[model samples]
Target: MRPGATRVGIIDYGMGNLYSVAKAVEHLGASAVVSDRAEVLAGTDRIIFPGVGAFGDCMAALEARELTDFVRVAAQTRPFLGICLGMQLLMESSEEHGAHAGLGLLPGRVLAFPPGAMRDRDGRPLKVPHMGWNELHQLVAHPLFAGIPQDAHFYFVHSFYVEPANPELLAAFADYGFPFCAAVAVDNLFALQCHPEKSGEAGLRLLGNFLAWDGGGGPACGI
Candidate 1:
């Protein structure tokens, strides 16, 4: 590894999109280390928490690995990025399988989209998962979307969405049946409901921006 190269720790509690997220970081010229050990992760410059499973299950895995508190602390000190279910875990609680508590890093609740409330452009009932590509409506100007265009299409596959207590945390929204939180940014923490690793160029750009971010709440530099 090059001297002083960004070391991104992709948190692996057996539920995240580990390899793909690591590869994405490596592709952006940063060192990617996917591990569950707090000591190993603590050595890195940034953290990427990516998940692809149920809220309760993922939280259990994190607890099993004794990483729940580790993550909560890490987010405060590093440039933290959470993706998909990883994003939901940062909230106060989730209603996925029942009332399950979250990391409470962000003040909010993860809620399931009401069934039969969403309709396609053609007026057909949309699926619950809300899969495939969708347009992101940028609600706030942040470094995470520095190069991405407004209303850019990104990949999404989720039934639950986060509702933050503080509206200022909202970075972007995407319409499924109605507008929903697609991304949130606060201080050093930035998270996304969409899989930027799977969203192609725009996603890659976003990841690159994250790799270069200094957690200063300003535009990413040295990209």
Candidate 2:
């Protein structure tokens, strides 16, 4: 928990690519411990909630492990980060398969891309699952944006996106059919729809920023 010696706990509920995230954290000189033990996570300076797979399944895993409430409370105080499905799980609920409940830490819903991929102006498929790299337009100034170029491309792979009821939670966005909350930050919470671990330089810069962020530096809700 000490400055410049932060210990990060990558929550492993048996779904996420823990090694990749842990490697990314370790590469940045921060100690990374990938575990599911609540006591271990409580001792870390920050927590990275990363996941993949279905919304219901992820919530089930968290609940099964009894880590859901801990995560909700953690996001309210410490520097907590959620990635992809991890981010979507923060919403109140999702329509992935018959209105499944979520962590409800953030005010939003996870909705699937409309039908199939919408056609671009040039008549090409925009592609669902939003697979591959895309540009992110910075919506507001935040510590996460430090040294990151505006509109920097990041790797993404998902069929759904988050819609924060309070738009102020949006830190950056990208337009597939329309703009969606690509990243969100409020108080001590930071979540992103894209995979910073796969985003190359821009993503690494973001990870580095998150590692150094003091939680007080990010723009608060309602600014």
Query: Which candidate should be chosen as best, given lDDT against the real structure?
Result: 1
lDDT against true structure, model 2:
0.87
Model 2: CA > 4 A from native: 1-4
Query: Clashes in model 2: which pairs?
Result: none
Report the C-alpha lDDT of model 1 over 88-149, residue by residue, as the tens digit: 99999999999999999888999999876788678889888989999999987788888999
Reference-based TM-score of each model: 0.95, 0.95
TM-score of 2: 0.95
User: Superposing every Cα of model 2 onto the true structure, what RMSD results?
Assistant: 2.1
Instruction: Give the alpha carbon lDDT tens digit for every residue of 182-206 in model 2.
Output: 9998877888999999899999999
Residue 91, model 1: Cα distance from true site in angstroms: 0.6
Candidate 1: which stretches are off by over 4 Å? 1-3, 218-223
